[model samples]
Target: MADTGLASERPLRSASFRWFLGGQSISLLGSAMSPVALAFAVLEATGSAAWLAAVTTAALVPMVAALLLGGGVADRHRRDSVLRLTSVGAGLTQAGVACVLLTHQHPAFLLPLCAFSGVFQGLTKPALRGIVANLAAGRGIQRASSLLASVRNTTKIIGPTTAGLLTASVGGGWAIAADAVSFLLAAVCFARMSLPDRPQRTADDPTMLGALREGWGYFSSQPWIWAVTLAFAVNNGFNLGVWQILGPVVANGTIGARGWGLVLSARGAGALLASVVMVKLTVRRPMGPALASMSLAAVPLILLGAGADTLWLAAASFVAGVATEFFTVVWETVNTTHIPERLLSRVGAHDEFWSFVPIPVSQLSTPFLAAAFGTASVAVLGGATAAVAMLLPLLVPALRRIEIHRQGE
Candidate 1:
């Protein structure tokens, strides 16, 4: 495929990309709501945080385990078809959860249903990456990614609030039902998309294991890709633990829950603003800027450790959000432009899998670390570690050398 100049061809002008964007926007909104609704439903039914934790773990573990398999499947089939099937599967599982909640309220029933839903969720992730690359060739990748990020940030603001209202009025079951419907509707949109044909696999094609090994080889060979992935693996763990786990405790002592909520809102607003700005701006070489921006993430954690006022914390969070979103768009665009289409899903899966592997560890260990070293101390240390992780990628000469050119250039 020839490079499509960003000025000459806007991603939205493509009917297929429009369809993709519309479906993903709706689907993401529902996904954002699902966790809130599920949390309330689990509490209402079981009345135990332990059970809720178990249910949540059940869902997440399966998703993580399935990621490599999902990547393989996505690479083997049409990406859109994979999306359609996974959406249908996820929708059905959610419907089952709704039925279980509405009638018997068997908490154990949720385990299998949510586990299956998580599997479907895992399957969709890599296919989503592949489909976006297919729909937005060349420089349009950045525009498409920015547009998608904008919708995602907007939904993060709206979806939970909507779910809370629905849960309060009707019930958590009904809110989940709404999520199920959204997935099914998204499946319809996927069915309607017109994607280019993929090359047919021959009998001589490598087996799934072999294909995965091939993907691993390619991923490892690219210092820019693996280096960034390694940095994120460390940075995300510290960021999540400090910001999500310790920040709440710090808020209770200083800013209060309401203040914490406002700070989070500011972050979302900042991300949305960055997404809008990135639609017009072009970065020929994104990795250096992306890594540099990621260091901004440390500010809010350090502020919380310092016992800053709510306004100061919120200001830091807003900048962090802008930095996070900017890095995300640039990272996605880099992958789409540089990685071969055949291996894109596999590489993306590896990136996501490693990035997520440390999350559970952080979630599990943060409180222990806090109890031993004190919450404020841990937050400060975490922020410093994250900043180092983000900046360390700059030391890799290969990562710093990567560049993408505009079509006409």
Candidate 2:
């Protein structure tokens, strides 16, 4: 028998999946441009990286907190409604940024606005994932996740490169306004989505708090989840700190501003190719070990830092992108498939809150780390530590059994 890529017999579900992918593709594109636009605007106006630095730092709290609270709410409420409402809120927020830009408003407003966007995301991201899990169904989850990774990479390609050109030509204000318009388009897509009834808790279940607690227990019971979540939090925090502290200085001051844009775009291109390759993969449940393996592959952040050139950086960036997408897709798909849908968002929050907990601290401290160790050395250390963290987990037998076949067994 010939195997068509179509996992489901029903055409309607397939159409819905396409619609979901289309919306996300548009959303990812605009988002990719945002950091480039924001950073450039800050530098051009104040002639100081301080504004960009401060807002990036300020964003950490609201993002993690909002994500936590939003996850709690998402588990208790209808995920569809939550996503719809937040998408509108996010669009309106972008509109406000656009209005500031359209009026030729001060660049001073940009950082705080970016921070606000972080708050908006904290509320919506969990629900977004929960919705995808519902939409993907069991058989289609891997493909759906892969499609998401590809779209994300595609946006990475479009966003930064476009922002670079746009900022160079039109000015930062207008580029920001373009991002705002993308959010409105995202809202329209969210409205058109028709999702199935969210998997409901059985009638005997208690309050939302009780439900939340149960999710906590369930996640805690899994040692590997806890271990990996901790590793990511620390690794992500450390990496972000380095990126924020060093990337701008290198790309703008040392490497050249255009270099930063190209470096970012190259990584996205790499991830896109990786996502395409992974989509056709079929294996018995092995997300856990795959995750550990890919995490080690991140060792090149060291190479990326030490090399730092068009050719060197691009090659390193490509490998890093491929590794990141592989781990991320496996991580998300495993979570979506294994965790009960009713508790999906809350569980996601639990994972995110803990895992991403170090981001703010890391972002805040990077400048100091760079000042103390020097940018190149600091980046090299971060990369080394991250690579070590990924492989050390092999000592845990639970992580070795992470394939789908062993989940909850």
Candidate 3:
């Protein structure tokens, strides 16, 4: 295996990777800011949890629907081109959202705008994963994943706090505007990036539908992949749904928006710390540790359900961040290393599609569930469900036995 020290530095040596990382860093900063900004904007304007759920659900549903098409397009075309185009589209839609929010906080206008952005997001998601796999191929996928996670986590730390301050002082529209600018800047960076040449597709190449089916066949054939994806389908509905939709609502009553931002920032801080550790850490049996760490995701949800104070909530979020980041780096590395490069994007899309399918349901249902069962009860139940779901994949022998070997191993 490549020496841990050398492996960590190798991905950075590539100029293309550098550009990719730089663009993603700037873009993630804005994206990190966006949820906080958008959540508060919707909540403050509508003052209805259901409305907030509706607006957020609008974005997620289309993204989930578009994943397979986007994945096929990404695998067939130059991944960088897909990224650049999608970034531009997302930027434009986000700008429209900012403009509407600034002029009049209208849910009617926001729904379609957010849905458009989500389509761009669907197009962008698989391409983003494929590009990293391409850029960092044969040069420490784990390190590359860690670096990306580090930047993302770092931005989360800064973005939410900034969004909170902006939302509190100038209004959420400006913060959303900042996110739009970042997307444009990222598009510019993506345009300039150069990737290794992909094999030209031939007339014999499968049609998009055929290709998607093939991808699904491979994805479902892999017990490890399908099992984990299935688990996340259930887990995300609980973890992300509660955290994103109900989190702000709970905070609105208790910790306030600014405090909520801080709690998220604390989670970012923990993830950033984990990213640093992952750069040096080596795991032969990655799946076990990955899923084990993922179970920690339940902590903050449980805490939030219990109406923990700001300090306690932040602390729990921090721990969850660490766990989540560890899982992310391991998961990305395993996929990149094990999957064929040509099929990676489509497979990734399938993985993402299944994993995220439940998110919209969670977002749409949580508000009503909370209304009926009470937010705290729902949250605790969600956390318990997430914890159990995260561990169930461990029972799959293929997943438990999966191991990775670095270069020279």
Off by over 4 Å in 1: 1-8, 36-55, 96-109, 164-175, 241-263, 301-313, 367-378
Off by over 4 Å in 3: 1-9
Residues 1-409, candidate 2: write the lDDT tens digits.
0222353322224655666677777777887887787677666666655555766665667788787677778877766667667767666666676666657677667556656777888988788767666565555677778878889998997788788777767765666677777776776776666666545778886676776687788778887778777777767876755665567656666555466677778889888987887676745656555665556444545655675576677677777788787777777777877778777887888888887778777767776777778777877888777766766656668676666432123
Any runs in candidate 2 off by more than 4 Å, and if so which?
1-13, 99-108, 198-205, 296-304, 405-409
lDDT (Cα atoms) of all candidates against the true structure = 0.79, 0.70, 0.88
Clashing pairs in 3: 1-407, 1-408, 1-409
Write one digit per residue (lDDT tens) for candidate 1, span 22-112.
8888888887677667766676676554555567656776787778888888888888889889989999999998898778567998989
C-alpha TM-score for every candidate? 0.86, 0.89, 0.97
Q: Of the pair 2 and 3, which is ahead by TM-score?
A: 3
Model 1 clash pairs? Answer: none
When sorted by TM-score, best at the front, the candidate numbers are 3, 2, 1
The TM-score of candidate 2 is 0.89
